[model samples]
Target: MHRLIAALVFLFCATVRVFPHADKVEDRLVMHFATGGHPPSNGRWEDINHRHLAEVKGTPTLTNIGPAVALQFNGYTDHMLVPIKPEDLPVTAISLAAWVIVNETMADGGIISYAQDNGPQEKGFALGFDERSFTFSLATEKADDGDGKLTRIRANTPLTAGKWHYVVGTYDGETMKLFVNGREEATSKEQGGKILYPAKGRFTIGAYIDDNEFHAMDGALYEAKVYGRAMVATEIQAAARQNRALLDHESSINKELKFVVAPYLQFGTRDSMTIMCETSAEAQMLVEYAERQPLVSRTRSEEARLINTVTLSGLKPHTQYFYRVTCTDKNGNVARSDILTLQTAPGPETPWAFGIIGDTQRNPEVTKRATDGIFALRPNMTIHCGDVVDDGFAKHQWVSDLFAPSATLFSHVPLFPVIGNHEKNAHWYYDYFHLPKPEYYYTFTYGNAQFFMIDSNKDLSPGSEQYRWLEAELRKSKATWKFTCHHHPCFSSDENDYGDRWKGKAPEGFRSGDENAQRLVELYEKYRVDVAFAGHIHSYERAWPILQMQVNQKNGVRYIVSGGGGGGLEQAAPQRAWFTVHVQRGHHYCYAAVHDRTIQFKAYDLEGRLFDTFELTKGR
Candidate 1:
């Protein structure tokens, strides 16, 4: 009984000590418009009861659309505007936040927009979402430019399945940021002009003009606020958590993208480049704010490897550009070292070549052999299509198999590494190398084809998230050859055991089966996934042009299991009919030659003698 009482007392004390930001003051204010019996017509009042307004829910019943109050609009000309007199007006930096549910995209001709009195474009910003996909669009216009600048942030998933979400925009002198559900989604500093004037115009909740098509907000809205001072990321994150509990209790929420993919395209005229890196963690948790921001103006996070990313601006594309990483130690010491160079992707006329390797396990010496061969060939870049290391993230395994032998070669050539089952155990792959998201799956476009890397070991089931992502990525591709690489071979020789190893024990959230492999095969048949590669069988087995296990001859995906890089030999068992091609048990590497018209593959033994060759002719 005494121990229980002491535990309760300890819990109370711990709760009291739990404030992470007690020192910093939060500049926040909230206002609610309570309408009596009748809904006010004038634009002065921001109505809190959306059901009466008819913005979202109907007259008979109010659909509790989470954060928003249903509003109604009668074809009136003037719009609704709420009085927002900040305690400290004209504060240099500030944040404007609100919750909105748009049942439809912004009306075209009526022009129900968000505007302020500062400048024409500075008037206000407008947000629209396409109903079918819930694609969001935010536009800012200036009178001088005549036409408004529109930026769209498409949600990977739809929002209007009756869900309430948070949207916040912040202006910090030079940079303008847009956040969705309290997570920063996009940013732009390329505006030619400044914010016309102080945020003096009346704060408008819905509709620019009175009773415009966009009036009274067709959807529901809940908590709204505007701060005179720029709220740090911690404040926003905490609010997001609270909002999730208060408003959206039963909706599927995704963690925000860690960082945006900074544009890689550059030209002779551009002097500097700005790369946007994202982080799911709050800025306060970052270890080195300077290294994370790098732009000199922002001092946000203090964590190393925070999602908030490093930006490299002022770059000359096509020219050799060198950069160094800036991180910090536990003591907050700035550690900026290891200068690296990136010779940006060549211009339209330049022809480039990259090599491909798969499954360099069993023998660490295989990395040396493959690197030596690839180096001799003088390929501009190299891609390891998964299974780089043998087992899970054992630190020593990486040293012995990956970095040691291939370090020299990789340092010279731009090497793209994918997540293999072996590389997933420790999550050390991202620490050693800086690839894109470091997720088990990702996509990148190369010279003529686009490459997709998937984590087959974890989840490859039909209708799974990875499968959906693959379909979306494949659909968005402009490349003629959509090449996919994973650690587990989708198709392999019956000789060496091939198929799903973790067939029954996939994680709870993941789908079961090599369904992804077969489904991918079907998708390849439909969308023309030119070549698929895998490494796990420890042998070199190539598939003939096949669709649903039948010979399509012309338009089918060819699977290559090149697991014999340095791994132990596993001979391919003989299989008849359209399913089998030449299966070799020799210790060899594979090379692909891609041209505008045709792509050719040659499997060569360690002695540099070609054993098997195949070609893919392009369509008219």
Candidate 2:
């Protein structure tokens, strides 16, 4: 009886093909990382049961999200390498599945890959993202290169940030498929034959690795599994269902996502204009612009990065163009801006108008109201007299206090700005604005008028570099009109700028305007500058054309202080100074339209009340 029973049991075990205590799901997995490497194998990630190990390349930390533990890549320099043999990867069919959460948009980075080369074209398989486009990549005999000629496939889904996702990519010998959240999202049939692969390649996780390790990913990665055979829709769905339990807690973080900075125009000229916007997280940027037709062009970052600054070229001079920006995170979340329009700079002889404002610091509501007035006028461009933000170092203020409030005006009008005292002379100003070399002090001529934008925060004394540049610029300019803009005033009559006369005539030390700024009066006198615009004090003051401390309407430089853009109101002296012709204390913006040698200058308050108007005309 014992002999018969033992013989029967042995036969049953042999036919059943049973050995380990793994579940059905685990039985099919050729290699698996259960806890970013459970049973923590020193500094390596050991497969759940298989001896296939991955050498941790960079410093990957551990994070416990909800009920699961994951490995975190720093995005800039973290990855893993599992040495893989040709036989280890199936030649006919294979599937790769992972639980991933991307921290930012990987403009060009890999999630997991085992490829032959690193160039645009290679011979292998990879799952990655580039320029807002994310997909599964597999190479075959029919493919021309590794990446471009029908070598990659992506779903129309957008990748979002701050959420865990289960993704699977597979090849079933005839078709390539991508599954997200257990559902098939994308499929292709170009790679029909056996997959072409590298003999001594390594399976890279959380980064792009082919010839070498290049693009590293940021965020956490959970169990990643590999199967030698193609995983059917049911198997992928089952696997995704199992992984979904651990992500129930982290699913609410995306409910209140912050948007990127509003789109703004910059570096605008006759033939080009740069449309710029910044994302809260790293994102791939795509800018589309059109003149008369649906002219579409795509742009990708040289690498996955944070800022998108694209210059639209081949634009027609004095022509209007419509543009918009779209940003995509690696997880397929997309954000797009509204379409806006801007006209390129007209020729010097063209009749055009530009608006000017100053001191729009720390007052959002007033700033918005003041800028709306400017936008309605539909000027060719807008000029900021400086102090765009109260604290230049606090980077967020640039978005809230400046960009957000003036979004409407800036979307359509390119802004030319001068640095103000409130800007703190920080590098952020230079990074935000795209201008000529040494952007702080530069010159650009538009529509018969030449503008010299000066950085009064820097030294403007007689022997300073700015002095020499101004001398050379003004001496050679032959435009119909010449204008100079600096933050500090060359002439002012604010209550205390000249002197704090609490109740009397005031003390010494204080002058009519900034002494350093006043020193440039000779240049205005010598060159016969049309207007000297400034914005230090928070009030509007239009001085009579002054030549040598006297009002000379014929050939003197007219100085105007349109400092009422937004700020606490200030008053003129108890007794008005000589340079002050007209003064107003309110939030306002100024507009100037130049036709031939004549300019019509008008200033209006937030109520749309024209408080000041003047005309300056020159002879032929």
Candidate 3:
């Protein structure tokens, strides 16, 4: 009897040692991606918790971390997808955790997801990056139509590219929480009963399984784990704490490089230019520049700050210059940027081309595509009619949504922007762009054209300061061509009209129409402006030369609404207005060439298809 008891005790001890956390282990799915070999040769990646192996597609490489393994995705077609089963679906509460090292910031891509098959009626959860922010989303079917409606919670801080980050998303039946770097960043109240799963659901990594809209991640993911039960904050923190040494090593390497936003050209003119960028910390900034040769001239900022601006003066007109920026942090860690080139504005009557695009606020991918199209045209300069970002106060939106995507374009071509309503007159807009004095409403002359960038969000009454200043500038301008760019439109047939009425009664003081539009239009007409560009509506509309609401092409001023610059498209009214000559609903931009006394305008959609073209000759 004693010998039997000893055998039983030994068996119980062995079982306890094998299943350390048996109670929690049964409700979790852990995938280490440590398939001992590379892809194509290594058929599948097994989930250590369950035997549910995921089929690897495309050429996914492998990397070693000490004795462990991690998968490297190419951001194109690399993905690991598992067929969904009854055991894979979460019933009530769920948590997803992953360690990722993003190589580049994408528009939208999933890190880990489980989604339904139907295109629009998909129901599931995904942890990914919406543009640049870490986001956790839950999609539920509508009670009426069964269409999917998404509820999302995004982290306040953006994840740094080329760095490892620990991310966790948890839903406890009432509230959804998103944690980044082991700290809670955002939360949302989602009181859904049970997580919904469609008939053809799938669990995928590196991309959305069912939707083609979301892009694949361009990064490396390690140790992806999912729990059927809600994971508490302590558990998530503990998991992240295990990698504290790894994160600290990364942080030390990052500190060696102090630059955050690279040096980009801004506020360029014939004899002057501004080089602006941001560093990771307070650093002394300097720019060494010369004309098409080794650096000979240097300009240094007097103060040490994160945001560095160095203006180079005495630059030759219509000349190209090579330059490089260097920054040194407090720790004596020096960072040097790549060599960049910049060309000053052309001399008067030199025949230059400039591009116009606006409302590039919400969508970064569309904005990048449109900017690339414009860049291919090789414009001397670019003009943005405001709404540079969806939320002006949100600094992340400016960096990720606007600045980062347009960095390449704006680095070469100087951008003169107007203030849109979305900016809310925030100081961030003023701080970012190096505009003329009274940055909101200012005029700049490029080549033979004098461009007026107005703040349409503020009051533009006849007696207002902006109105008076605009009148004075117009009266004094001696340039051959005069163009005005603002946010709100005096005439728009699109559904986004501020007052709903497209053709309203003209106010007494201003002849254009009621509201601020009337006063602004009167100034444009009185000043004999060649063409006025406005972009509040999210569609392209070009009006005939209208003077006092009448189409008089001779002395009237033309209005072109080029608001379709990456923002969501808006549909125009069915019945076209008398002044509306051409209208198209799509993402588009305008390219204008000025030579002698004539200006040629061509509107091209995102695909480079020319939809509208017109020429204006100044009656000299």
Candidate 4:
């Protein structure tokens, strides 16, 4: 009985000790939207002091700040409603705070949009954010139509997603201020004068609400607090120091790491393959697999890391195996992943299938459709020709736009990617994927075919590093089928990207097929490369077999421009060029089946429409 009573006492003490601001000036704090809660779904957060209570709606996921866990809105229909009697509303001087992580930028996202109307009188003000920047808005009056004419001041720092922030906005009768983390970012003296409160009011969190519809927030809010009196700079700064401690605690939630990017396969050769994943914390990773019996392997890095890669070798060629990844943080807390599978490459005589996509950027929804379609095709492997993300430097897009859509496909199949112009040769790309030395250009052989991945963003002309490497590699490749892929099309029926030949106008900068990449045409012809693939035009085009820039069906190379991965669809040249055979503008992915001396390829749009098909045979 004594031990249970002691535990209860500790729990009571912990519940009340939520924030530094509240502990410092308990009487001045009107409410903290999330005072004490377990991984909350939806319920009431009543002020312990009996001042106010917030009604939660929909389900907000749990998010942690420091040691405190708060709610994260889904940006669609999640919100919290706080009713404030006239006596509780801050009328003249007010301060608002939100510990947040914003996922998307929006025009009217309300970290807190406040307004309370009582009969003919309005009694509240709103606190909202611009995402890229935070804004503090105050108004002395509202229009008769019931809209506030707020005086706004903005902070400079962009509130990027996937990180924590301590944002504060305040208004004292003479000045308005906005602070991020703990330092002052902006100030304004526009609204000034006395603000009024009516007989009753309301303070809302997670959304902007009034007589107008609610503008939901696309972020996680660790806490939202209201102070009856505007806090001075020194007090706010001191409170920020305490916030820093809380954020430090946020480093690892619940004492364990989370899977940021789930386990996926990479670099699969006949006898070896790599298993990779990323976690939120620097943690040691262990991978277990089974072919006929269970086997274990540790990550390559001796030190802890957010990215963990495990290579499994000495396996049978063309064999399948099931595997799972486990992450263990320093505290010994563990996270385990579901079991998945992978297949090793087969010998040259075995048949194989693969999927190809290009320019998968900016549109994850469409990308998801394409990826799902590809997954349905059950290719043994996948290739992203280039432009994997809208900006290769923006690491978040790599997860959101590329990896998310990859879904079940990547879990089972390996991916080989080239560097596109959009990648900008960012370090994140290199860190995320374990590729060969000089990652920008490399070659891989699977079954009977060999793929040459080029970095079109670099100089591929004669004498350039990629040019010399490709010439040497192509000459040495004795595979039955040889294919080359890059970002810029060697032959595309693209209109403006190439010169606007229909109007007889030279392109401002770009041309249809890259002149530099086109230089490889001579090399491809000489080496008898079967097919050249690229994506930059955001459409699908296949050129007639050509040699020496002229049609040569007997022994010439074919060019395919399959840019329609996820970017907005683009158009082909107004009229077919001399080398054009088929051109279709749409979002798409391609799948191919290969066997000795024969290749069967097909293209499909997002809705699973089989738009085109063709076959290539050696020594036909």
Q: Over the stretch 391-471, how does candidate 3's per-residue lDDT look in tens digits?
A: 889888887888778877887788889989888888888778888888998888899989888887888898899999999
lDDT by residue for model 4 (125-230), tens: 6667764677776666432234434566778877655456778888787788899888899997766656654333446688876664467776677667788778
Cα RMSD (Å) per model? 20.3, 13.7, 20.5, 17.0
Ranking by TM-score: 2, 4, 3, 1
lDDT of 1 by residue, 1-620 (tens): 34533443344233222222321444543333322212333223333422113232112111222222223221122234544343323335545665554433433311123443223333344333444432222333222355344443444444553345666666565455666676766666544233333234334444443222233343434434455445567777776776564345442212222211111111111232222222233322211112221222222234554333443444444455544333322222222223344455443344556667777864767678877787667565677767777775575676667656665556445666666666654566665545556456777766567888877766666678888888888888888678888877776654425322334233433221134466677667777888888776676778777777776788767888777667677764444424568788777777776666577778877777888988778886
Against the hidden reference, what TM-scores do the models get?
0.46, 0.61, 0.58, 0.59
The global C-alpha lDDT for each of the candidates, from Candidate 1 onward, is: 0.51, 0.77, 0.75, 0.75
- Ranked by lDDT, the better of candidates 2 and 4 is 2
lDDT tens digits, residue span 360-428, model 2: 988999999999999888899989999998999988888788889988988899999999999998887
Candidate 2 local Cα displacement, residue 238, angstroms? 14
Error of 4 at 500 (Å): 2.6
Model 1 RMSD in angstroms:
20.3
Error of 4 at 452 (Å): 0.9
Error of 3 at 613 (Å): 1.0
| Residue 288 lDDT, candidate 4, scale 0-100 | 68
* Residue 286 Cα positional deviation in candidate 1, in Å, after optimal superposition: 19
